[model samples]
Target: MGIKIVPRHGKSLKDKLYLPAIAGGMKTTFTHFVKNLKDTSNLKTMSYPEVQPEDLSERYRGVHRLTKWDDGSEKCVACYMCATACPANCIFIDAEERFDGVAEKRPKQFKIDLLECVYCGYCVEACPCDAIRMDTGIFSFTGSSREEFVVDKEYLMSNERSKDLNDG
Candidate 1:
């Protein structure tokens, strides 16, 4: 018994070169350019720094902040819910018993590596006590080193909601 092999056709010169795809992309670009030239009102581009967006959606998720009670104590009960729910595993916390009786436990150490965080708001959603929020409206952040980007408990607690992106 013998096995017969079937011959397959190779890609054409145009297919190999991707000329059709390139032409399609160029056509799209030209069409959009001409449409934009005819009607510039549809453009949503903004001049940043000099003129910021007047309104950011309420649902906009920006920087994370740990909320505090009226007496200035952290609202977090050290439940570890936020850390567990974070898909990026950016949150780190060490809990200690609270002898003061304000809460059963408090975070002895809490840190969030912004670089590792995806900013998906999972931590905020997981906090049962509403101890964390992403309402600072700080979309832009810069750090000199990796250590600088890891915000500690104090930094997260001190972070307040900004009136605008520039305010933060």
Candidate 2:
């Protein structure tokens, strides 16, 4: 058998497969580019800061919250149920008996690392006394440091009060 010389008039089979793919990718990019070029549509993004998401209601589930009682006292007994149920191990609690005597235990140092929290709501479900919950609705959180991300009980408790004030 002898090799035959053919004229280079067209693209090869490899080019046929890859050219269409390149064309499709370019078409997609161009389509988006054109859409963005039209200021009437503004197909980029929201104005941000000026256009933030709305607040969640009392019933709405958001970031984890530790609620205090009507008498301006912490409701958490810190039974470790919430910590045990937390899939991400975000909830950290140190229980100590209260002087009030009625409430056996309160969280001495309750901290939840939002970075590690999966927001699965298991901690909320595991609370027997309804102390820990995801109802505060202050979901927007960002931190530059690990210390900032580790939200202690004070911040969470104050957040609940702020929400209460807003709702009222």
| TM-score to true structure, per model | 0.71, 0.75
> By TM-score, how accurate is candidate 1?
0.71
Candidate 1: segments with Cα more than 4 A from true spot = 1-10, 19-45, 164-168
* lDDT string, candidate 1, 1-168, tens digits: 699998765478877888888999999999999999999999989888667676877778888899998899999999999999999999999999998888899999999999999999999888999999999877777889999999999999989987765454
Which pairs of residues collide in candidate 1? none
RMSD of each: 5.7, 7.9
User: What lDDT does model 1 reach?
Assistant: 0.90
Tens digits of lDDT, candidate 2, 39-123: 6565646686567555545565567767888887888888999999989998889988789975877889999999898888888
State the weakest 10-residue window (summed lDDT) of model 2: 159-168
